[model samples]
Target: MFIDAIGTQHNPATDARIISLVPSITELLFDMGLGGNLVGRTAFCVHPKEQVKQVKSIGGTKQVNLEKVKKLKATHLIVNIDENPKELVEELSKLIPHIVVTHPNKPADNIDLFSLIGNIFDRKGEAARLISELQAAQTQAQLSAMELDEKKVLYFIWKEPWMTIAPETYISQSLKIANMITYPQESDIRYPEIDLETGILDQVDAVLFSSEPFLFKSEHLKEFAQTYKVPADKLHIIDGEMTSWYGSRAIQGLRYLSDFAKGL
Candidate 1:
């Protein structure tokens, strides 16, 4: 069978040894009922903790131990487009079958990507189920969010330089579907650096801090709240997976967003 990007084919039924380089794709593999086939995973693929415990970790997505990967005899090596360097993928391409999963920063792009992954892994039925579920969840989130008249919110991914989600990003789309507006909705950059002196924070109704890249905790939220003079209740520390990962993990995102809407 032909897979996207990575031009490698093997008997889907017999290709039992697999290595996942991306956390989202690893979660998808598990969701597709291929958890038993996973032989190795990156250190970052920590979902389904039990399954993760069973697999050997090569390293992080950007710094995989190629020697260890080769020694593991992995039949398939799945890498994310942005997470793994292209040179490394090219090098690994010569050793084993590699599948490159392009990161979809927008919700719209995710449609075809999900279908492609399903087709590649011969899990079309599960993919369809997941797609249907996501579509339904999106609809529910939209409807629930529409009922609220909350002000525009700003979502920060990093703290040091203050990086935020852009208008066309997946997180922005999810927030929009949930009826929440982003502060800089027209910015073309998917992840842009924000200027603290720009008075942009004054326009936002709430600030959401994600737990990734920069792990924001209650103390971090308190600092922002004190600095901006915004209420502590306005700062929400959200799960990064819910706002980011565009796979089966999104099934959980819908539920979390729905609950967030109810709270609003």
Candidate 2:
């Protein structure tokens, strides 16, 4: 048996019919050799591209298609505290027997995540291997971070009105391991809209544009630089998944971060 992020009990199941709402966890399921057991996934669960194509899509994280979910007859449903809407999970719980809620707040949190999903799906051996690999990656990242100067960065996630993440988010913690501290160290909201004219850039050593949620391109740098005081050298586009995806990908992400910090 395993306890989920929400303290729900889940026993090991030989007959696990799983449906995942979180993309990272969905990818982790495949890595744990439980891809055959996954019957449904959200539309955003696109990693392991070819294999995930086999799993039927219920819908996106928030707007889940209950009708399609019913047809799949999934015994276990996976959700995330930040990604999946609470009401949606509550509604699905009436039909699905087990709801495994995940909330991986930092890079290291993936350790518990591996044990939680792996043990429940009877893939304890695979989970142990992943845990070992992730730990080794952490050690390597720390060594790399030691050689570089710690930087304060303002990471952009969206651009319509221009949004940035708070320090407490998973993305922030992931970057922190690379010795990149997210600015606005504190915020009233998790994701806050910022004004370019307000001079937040002055406080940050670098300004990063994430390549997801809102695809930040090189062109954005030239356009924004034309108006703002940001230096071209201080701005770079980062692979959003490496910082956001907390799963088997995190092992690779740690390596990516270590490499990314060395170039800085």
Candidate 3:
């Protein structure tokens, strides 16, 4: 029996018909050599873009087509704490026998998730190798970060409401590995909504615009630069997946952050 991140108890199925709602986990599943085992995935689970076509799409992360999921006849389901809603998980619990929910707040958490998924899917060797590589990559990032000068950065996730990634977030922890410091100093809220009128630019060295959830283009950057009176050179568009997604993607993410840190 395996206890998921949400404390759900389940016995691993001999032939797990996995349905993945979390996009990152879908990518992780494919990376862990479990793509052949996937029965269904969300429309948004587009990573390993070519492989997604082979899997059936249920719906989005927040709202999945339960009827469609039922039709797929999945034995196991994969989800995330932040990406998936509780009620949806509860509803799916009745339909799917084994539901594994993962919440990775750091690189270590990701390794644990790999191990858990690997054991459940009987891919222990592959999971061990993945964890080792991720740990090695993270160590390299830490070493690289030691050499780089720390830059005070504000990472934006949403533009409409203007929210910044909080210090407690996984992305912020990942940024620390790259010698990038996120702002405001302390906030219990995960993604705090910001007020541009408050003049936050004075405290930040740079403004990082995310490419996911909210696509921040050059025009938005120009607008922000004008509003904050920040120079254009201090603005950059970051791949959100590299900064946020935790899974096999984090291996590539750490490498990207390392290079991103080097450039800074």
Which candidate leads the pack in TM-score?
2
RMSD of each: 2.6, 1.1, 1.3
Per residue, candidate 1 scores C-alpha lDDT tens digits across 1-264 of 544544445344445578888888888888878788888898989988887788899888788787888898776777766568888777777777655546666555556567766776677888788888878877777777767776588889997789997787778877776777887877867688888788877888788888986889999988888887888888888788887887788777867877875665
lDDT of 2 at 43: 94
User: What TM-score against the true fold does each predicted structure earn?
Assistant: 0.88, 0.97, 0.96
Kindly report which residue pairs in candidate 3 clash with one another.
Answer: none
**Clash count per candidate:** 0, 0, 0
Ranking by lDDT: 2, 3, 1
Off by over 4 Å in 2: none
In model 3, where do residues sit more than 4 Å from their true spots? Answer: none
Model 1 TM-score (2 dp)? 0.88
Query: How big is the positional error of residue 63 in model 2, measured in Å on the Cα after superposition?
Result: 0.7
Candidate 3 lDDT over 1-264, as tens digits, reads 766787867665557899998899999989888998999998888989998899999989889887898898998988888888899989999999877889888866888888888888988888999999999999999988889999999889997788997787899999988989998868888888988777678788888999988888999999987876789999999999998889999998999999987776
Clashing pairs in 1: none
Q: Report the CA-based lDDT of candidate 2 relative to the real structure.
A: 0.91
TM-score of 2: 0.97
Off by over 4 Å in 1: 1-16, 108-110
